[model samples]
Target: MSLSRLVQRLRHAALCAAVGLMAAVPAAHAQSDADAGAFPAKPLRFIVPYPPGGPLDLMARALGEKVRASLGQPVIIENRAGAGGNIGADVAAKAAPDGYTLVMGAVATHAINPWLYASLPYDPIKDFAPITLVAAVPNVLVMNKEFAQANGIASVADLIAYGKRHPGRLNYGSGGNGSAGHLAGELLKARAGLDALHVPYQGAAPAQLALLSGQSDFMFDNLAAAAPLIRDGKVQALAVTTLARSSLLADVPTIDESGVPGFDLGTWFGVFATGGTPEPVVQKLNQAYVQALRQPDIVDRLRVMGSQAQPLSAQDFARMVAAEKEKYREIVKLSGASIN
Candidate 1:
């Protein structure tokens, strides 16, 4: 064939190939849109970064049961407890962004741990998409009954007076160095201008035991866990750590009201997915969980456990997380809590 004719034929073939590729792009986008429309075709894995029987684990199960019916798929709860909830959070953070995998992230996992740990596997703010803030349980300031009686400590003022009179005489116990309870104690010491020793235990249960055995002077404990003891007169409830008094212990005063103004801290958890999950999927998940939280049964159950179901929009929850992260940075430094 002539050279000019051959060149023309090659150009025509190349143009046809380009046209075919252009046509395929729209088809690919349509497939993607279809897949998104049919989200959650399989079981959803909800990771609770704590062991069984804990508040986070129980809440995860409750939410899973509720969301399953709405989403038309099983919401399986997985307990991936370790490293102050970092393990499970990392798992969800690294999961595919299709929104099938979720995590029940807590103050420890997302807010406190980011500041407490020297190095972390996941970026608390950047690694996950916030769905909604689920609930918050207050921590109560309790004293051993005998100790309180001996020290003449009836109110937060009395306790502060006693601590001032005998600096370094008051020692408190907590779950560990960087746990919420520990930070609470440190924050109290700083705000109240009191000197005290901190005793770290293996877990909250052990720390509560120490308090009961009179091995430690006082500690900040979860209201639900401390309720039975308070009811049985095992410990004296001084004040609640949150700004508002708990309905379960309506008689108890808040730390802010007691003496320290603007004092507010609690154990809160929320739902999160991989950072890049589609906005529509995140909204679907948020709506389902928020609906679950609003149920009368769920609200009543959480209230009995000294918690309140707080369902915020995804954007609002993200703002809360960022504020909490910054707040805890100061607290962690004040406590000098760190892990390598």
Candidate 2:
């Protein structure tokens, strides 16, 4: 072979290697542009699936403050309360998969509704992308101070005694059928051998209203939603519906520790974007909320409202959602609660 020919062959090999390297590394400009425009271009919408003062709503507002500071965009809170969070969840699920839209979802919307409804509109796992879980707030057994004082019902024991004494006479109100509140009441009846009638209302706010109006005897309300009312002496806290005591209500005993021995049930809130949102967008969202949940003030505030922040990665959140769905399936079946 001639020397010039060999030099030409080496030149060809060098050109091929250069092309391969360019292909292996994506274009720098494309990557930089994506990084710059990942998220936070405009104001983001945060939909709360319940009334304004509920635990899910409180978490959305609290986390929104920290997330806006980090993401450099205003976070707007929209209240779409109805059908035990189904109305808002359906709206969020159908929103564009763009990262600008997100919903503060609850166990009732994602896990229990599908099991309870015969023809549910949205598919929880298929229609949303899991972001971090904001917190797990337990249910607190609450009654109007007026009724409690009149009846001398001071604690869980007293409430249980009254319930057993009057089977169909005792009534409890919940957000709606198949809601965490409703299921919690059923669980209480099953465990404590009480014959309490289940009263379903439009939302937690109205259910609480019914309790205060003396339309209902007692209720299991989210601790955060009942916090202000409880603090204001509008309602009395009998017991928290978790096996372990709630940090926010340290003075309140767990239902398990009360008379029921092993009563454990509660609700959790998590952030979710429309399914099919870009993976990078989802990651950015998870990072923002998780970071906010870790902040000292945010963490402390949530805990104070009975929303104990539980930050989780996207994968972990997805796994947790699946497990929660399965767990609630049996609960719904046993309770025989359904909507539409």
Candidate 3:
């Protein structure tokens, strides 16, 4: 054979060997897909980026109890709270894309924290695959019952007027800097053109305590946690932070209806796995959580907690997360909030 033909034959043999080798071992990519196909074949670790007893932890525990039954594996709850949920979220983000690790991602984890921290440990959009939105609860603008009565504040309008009159004297407390409560207060301030001071506490419970102790005049707090206080007459609900009235609190009007037209804000909890998790795994998770939410006991318990179970498909949930992320970005800009 000529030299050129010999060189061509050698290249053909090399290409055949490469193809055989490629067919022989599909290492990194094939294993994960195989694992996902048999997803949750073993116990899964569920991370809640908050301490036990908080709403996120409670929701995870509630859903985990049911999902584990369907998954046929224990769903272990791990609390990794810190850095406004960034610590735990980063852990989830950096975790193996194997289908075993999941996180109960909250508004802070997937939406607000990215904007609040100048250098976030995780990328909300890039680091995780949204399984589904678990639930959304309204936030109620509330004040100490005695404080409202003493100040003669009867409604959203009254509160705004009082703030205007008192200017910086009206103080509001929040779970922490850039928390939903803080942003709600800032939103109200911008919409109503009131002058008020923002006080940040360690957590929602502490912020509510500040209100009860009269250290702060008011706060926008989760209806689930604040509803009992409102019902027991410890705190008075001024208006809910939603465009529409919360079904659990029908008697209370929405901020849009009360005085601030077009006002709407609320908190959401969702499930997410590391970004490259197999889509099949994500769909499986979405189905489990959706079915879990539909359980009568879960529905009843959520209602009692002042929230409703929202079961959306993975696609729909992704759209919701995207919109919320945009909304939070705007709010963070408007409020000029940053952890740095």
Candidate 4:
């Protein structure tokens, strides 16, 4: 037993530690590769941040069914409806970035909520990896048939003229204070320089009922929900709240074309994964959702529901979201819409 024997023992121990560390590095890399290849090895949680039976929920279920066939995994729809879709969006934002969790993000969640909410739980642009846009539904300017007839408001121009003449007399009803319908009404007021009272109901159905019962003068109603009422001569359709006319309401003009220049708004929703999801997985999700959107049945169903499915690539979708968010920032500020 000497100093030389002790030094040899130390050297042998150091070499063994180095060998073990090298082996562990390779094993870690192998595990990572395996995980990368197993994209969506289990069911995916598809969050629809609204209540069931709505367009977003129905479309999510349809897309989930279609994608399940191709991805070989079930897409579970999780409706987390509250705080104007912020709760569900926050859930998806904080979820693991393994591409298994996705949220059906909408204009409200990604664009409007960021600006409306006093403190948002997540950054819409930074916290999500865009998959693809699912659908866009146009809002229609509909008035009670009796109100329009009695007031001589046969078109958007007439309504604007009457509103300007009557000032605070013409009132509009919406789903809620900060809802898209309310915002649309506010935008209309701003654009046309008309003064109208905003009457907010607990939900769109209630707002539409107010309009139908003549409790409210008019409303910015979802075209899908108002289409039947309009067809039945219960409500009079004036114009759609989109730059482009809705195919379902072929004869109707857009607010942009109805004397309110530069006016455009719609309900648009899409899919988004956790921000740090791998690029390949994002692309795969885009393809799957876009494919589902392009299906003949899906296309027809959306058309019937007054929604248009125009899917875009993931990069393009991201750009669209960014642009829309900026657009809504100004709109929300102008509307003075806020949430605590």
The candidate scoring highest on lDDT is: 1
TM-score, model 2 to reference: 0.78
Best by TM-score: 1
Q: For model 3, name the residue pairs that clash.
A: none
Compared with the true structure, what per-residue lDDT tens digits does model 4 show for residues 1-340?
A: 2112222344466467768789586776566556568777899999988899888899899999999998899999999999999999999999999899999999999999998999999999999999988777889999989989988999889998998788779889999978999999999988898789999899999999899899999999989999999888899999998777888999999888889887878888889999999886887788788889999999998999887677777876787788788888888998887888
TM-score: which is higher, 1 or 2?
1
- Per-candidate Cα RMSD to the true structure, in Å, reads 15.0, 13.8, 13.6, 15.4
True-structure Cα RMSD, model 2: 13.8
lDDT string, candidate 3, 109-158, tens digits: 88888788989878898888888777777889998788899989989999
Q: 2 or 4, which is superior by lDDT?
A: 4
Error of 3 at 120 (Å): 0.8
* lDDT to native, each model: 0.88, 0.82, 0.83, 0.87
Candidate 4 residue 303 C-alpha distance from true site, Å: 0.6
- Predict model 4's lDDT versus the native: 0.87
lDDT: worst 10-residue window of model 4:
1-10
Which residue runs of candidate 4 sit more than 4 Å off their true CA positions? 1-36
Q: TM-scores of the models, in the given order?
A: 0.89, 0.78, 0.87, 0.89
